[model samples]
Target: MMSKKLWEGSKQFKEHSHLHDYKLWLATSKGLKFKNYQELWQWSVTEVEDFWESMWNYFNVISHKPYSKVLSSHQMPDCKWFEGATINYAEHLFRKAKDNETAIIFGNEAGINQDISWLELKTKVASLATYFKSIGVTKGDRVVAFLPNIPEATIAFLAVNSIGAIWSSTSPDFGSESVVDRFAQIEPKVLIAVDGYQYNGKPYDKSNIVNAIVDALPTLKKVLVLPYLNTNALDNFPKHYENINHIFNTVSGELTFEPVAFNHPIWVLYSSGTTGLPKAIVHSHGGILLEHLKYMAFHNDVHEGERFFWFSTTGWMMWNFVQAAFLMGASIVLYDGSPTYPNFNALWKFSEDVKIAHFGTSAPYLVACMKKGLMPKAEFDLYSIRSISSTGAPLPPEAFDYVYANIKDDVWLCSMAGGTDVCTAFVGGVPEYAVHSGEIQCRALGVSLYAYDDHGNPVEDQLGEMVIDKPMPSMPIYFWNDTDNKRYKASYFEHYPGKWRHGDFIRINSKTNGLVIYGRSDATLNRHGIRIGTSEIYRAVNKIKAVEDSLIVNLELEEGKHYMPLFVKMKNSAKLTDEVKSQINNQLKKEYSPRHVPDEIIQVDDIPYTISGKKMEAPIKKILLGMSLEKSINFDSMRNPESVQFFIEFATQI
Candidate 1:
């Protein structure tokens, strides 16, 4: 099949592109000509220091102290950026704000929509920051949040960062065990939590979970609870616990942004915990600030006053990205509860109603909408939307077609792939370039992405391990509680010994210079010594009208034999007939390879997914390999934990 260009950059879009402006500036100041995005990307990867220095200036990053050097050294793990510079993350987010402009728009599954003006948001953050200082919070102190995707979570994070205190957060849906496993490692001094939260029109009381977490964390000096679900929920808790209103009402002060070193940790992000206990990946104040500004302004092409919305919980990294929209002077749209509470069109209708300019969500949501044949263009007035981004999984080519054909033909659809390690996309959308179906427009500026074969040599147009030859500004400063940097090294550098191995299977198209991600390399299928990406199989299986979703795992059996099984979730009226199986096999053989066909195709009730909507492939593979459920995955991190039982039962029969 031939690839189609979905959208072309208009003159207005080119004028708004931060990258385009930078290109013009480069030609005028540095006497360098970058005629296209490809030439600009080549220079960016070749002269890394110059590119980053230019980015720092282009974003107009506010710094209290000048850096002694642009880069201290070229070491992978020890690369120091902007040495001696001091800055505060919250300062950039709240700067250049108009009092009357909207800063945050909150929406819930129950049709609750509210907006907070810039002045109101600033006032709330100032009050919380003052209260935090009164409670002995200071630089390097940890403040953990177990809250929903409400305005309070954003305020708490800003307040924590405003004082140079490190912030960490997880969704309220996580159980006490999962929450403690993450927050306990950091030894936070303050615990910000919700009394309860609502999802899919059902209220869940999280008071007990918060109590358990507070009881387990000995370093917690104070507990602040928000009345999220039920207003009276906090009354049942102990009197020692503080109410959110008490802090907001008694404090009155201007927010002070404490300037710390560029490398000073700002927040701790946890891994998926599919293999073992979650790794607390810590990011710095200046590193995250500069990175997010570039990612949001240039890659997303976010203009001031544009409405940016991404359906995410506080647990996901995208929520942190959404917070960065304020840095670009853009209004953030926050949504809590299910994206499809009433129906699959809930988000589409809401996006139209609110006139969201830039919308972000996962590939699974788009794929489900495509399979159900939901015509969003016919139902909703989405002319206000300029771009839509999909992540969390590889977007099937069919989903790409569905978006242009059924959603909007003129809109830009970006299928980006990045992980929690860097908290940004290595390959993402570039508004200045044409978007091809099922491909990321370009490698993000300043990110040195290369696909490496087994011998550690770079290759083009062939799927291989995705690796970074240089350190990104947003790479984790360090892992919390990881002394001697042993765990951090083992996680990324162990495979290649020096470079950053991102653990994803990917290829860069030679013709279009676009990125096509296969699934995670760890979950790739290897049959008869031939490796195949899971996306190749998924593309074929998901094309069948009957299949709703699918999963495949390669198992090593007795006598060095192998068995590759494919589990499929079918539609209600569809059956896994022999003709259907034959069609799938034939499609795989013709499109991918003869080896792409699985040994057995089994029907399953549902596919397991993380709370962030990623297919739980690695965790399921571990469970099918004889590992117990508790050891494979944390149940609290799953959207439907019961779906894991199907794999465990299938493992027994094998």
Candidate 2:
């Protein structure tokens, strides 16, 4: 049993203790009052219908067509949410129109700040909407963007959604082939591009690549170029392409918004596709908008006029999530350059300057900050920050400690877990919960999550496959161009019969009432029929000094048996010596079983990652197995793909 002191001290648990109107409705509407997290979770699975129905009502999700039924049946694969409901995703997001409120604050490593008020944002979106309508762009038409995470990108997204047109985008850094691989498949009617982008004190000219991609895609009707960098290259721009100003000039009258069905496609977000071509995960208008609001209002506790900043690119799902803040009348902060370009304190400086309330970033960014040994508490006055959210990967326990000790004493460290597939979090913070050490506070409200053992039974206080037993409103409507739902089923439902397998190896701690996400299940290492998470080895290895980061892979022997091999990347001015390798081995053997010790340990200069900043483990595994390196789906932000050849050479030698 959890101690009373721990529960009360928890920021999340204490906030929900009082019986608010919403809380009362959730408790009685679904009979969800439980003695503990376990009881509430178990009851949620059994009473899936009541749980979701109550959640929709509790959140006050506006719908044109009321849901005739909450769920279809007990079938996991076929489970549906808000059945027969019709709603406009953009309308819900724009519900907050209170005058002159700050809607967006854009920044960069060069210390540039661009603030946009709600009224200004609305005007720009309306103008963009008028342009789209005048150009024969209508509902269901695909509008693709290859832009940075600037205010214009967010405006374009809202404009596309406002007119019921489907929007898809990638960061400007994506190569021509990678961009072509995705946008070509969708046959987008309109393409949005920027001339160039600035990153890490360098200017990258994407106009050439953008011109090349537009030349290849025959289905593209028109290309709209935004004058980025204030360069006079507009004349040098492609003759076939039209300037953004020209498109808006054609739009003359008041904007007219056409509301579509609840499941209308809003955006087509592609997977990294390191192994093959990327999968286009299509999210619905209602699902993305409503789920984001749920997370923003309830999970992040974002109040009106608060400043929100998340360092992300247009390629990342966080960019999409951050744009939703405009709907809440919050100031959405956007940064375009490297987080540590001029100094390690760039982001901190921006936070202080903007007086941000909610700050979101990747775990690696925090880990990198900790590695630099720079303390923000001493450098800057960060009294404005109330919450700090970390995602992209499992936050190391040491980073958690570093944050609490240096960033803020009373701020909530919300370690969120979800993927681009859903466009929102499945497990994250609720204001009424406590922040646990190295754990996400709680499963998202209304998301029926469970940890199931191999026997398909729910497990408690143990590591198991993370699955959602019931459907939620945020579940993807379908895969793009997948008429038969074949790709959708194969992606999520093929692992488990009916349940939504989230593909994470996680453990729910009954003692602390928190969750520990070990790593991705596909990346799980198998030794002597025992499945162990790779993060288990990382946790042990990262604890050692001189080791900045590490990656572990399971190598198959001649007999088809797998053995574990480890790779380490040392800190700057540090090397992985024999002593360091021995120390890592000793720690692994002592903490885990003897079998957990890797067969070999090698050092590498750097690790390859997806555009979204996840370590590309599957490609490394393929390289170790002597397989061809398949083209990456989103290669724009991918750094150092050639480094994998070093791993391949080391694998052959071993």
Give the C-alpha lDDT of model 1.
0.88
Global CA lDDT computed for model 2: 0.78
TM-score of each: 0.98, 0.93
Best by TM-score, which number? 1
Query: Which stretches in model 1 have alpha-carbon errors above 4 Å?
Result: 573-575
Per-residue lDDT of candidate 2, residues 1-654 (tens digit) = 342221123544345432233455567865556654445556655776775555567657778778777767666445566667877777766777654867788888777887788777777788888888878999999999999998889888889988899999999877888788788878999999998888889888876888898888898888889888655647767677777766555554454457777777888998886676678888887667667766787677777778888999998889988977765667788889888888888999889998999999998899888777778988889999988999998987778888878877778788889998888888887555567667787887667787989887878777899998777666777777787888888888988867799899888777665788888988888888788888778778877878888888897778777767788889884777999988999999998888889988888887778777898776787677776545322344466666666776775765
RMSD of 1: 1.4
Put down candidate 1 lDDT per residue, 1-654, tens digits, no spaces.
236777888998787687778888888878889778888888888898888888788778889999998887767887889999999999999986899989998888888899999998899999999999999999999999998898989999999999999999999888888889899999999999998888887889988888999999999999998887788867879998898977888788997899999999989999977567899999888888888888887799888999999989899999898999998899999988888888889999889888999999998889889999999999999999989999999998889999999999888887888878888899999877788888888899888889999899999988889999887888998898888899999989999877999899998888888989999899989999988888888989988888888999888777989889898988994778898899889989988888999999988899998777888888988888888778888887777889988888887887
Candidate 2 TM-score to native: 0.93
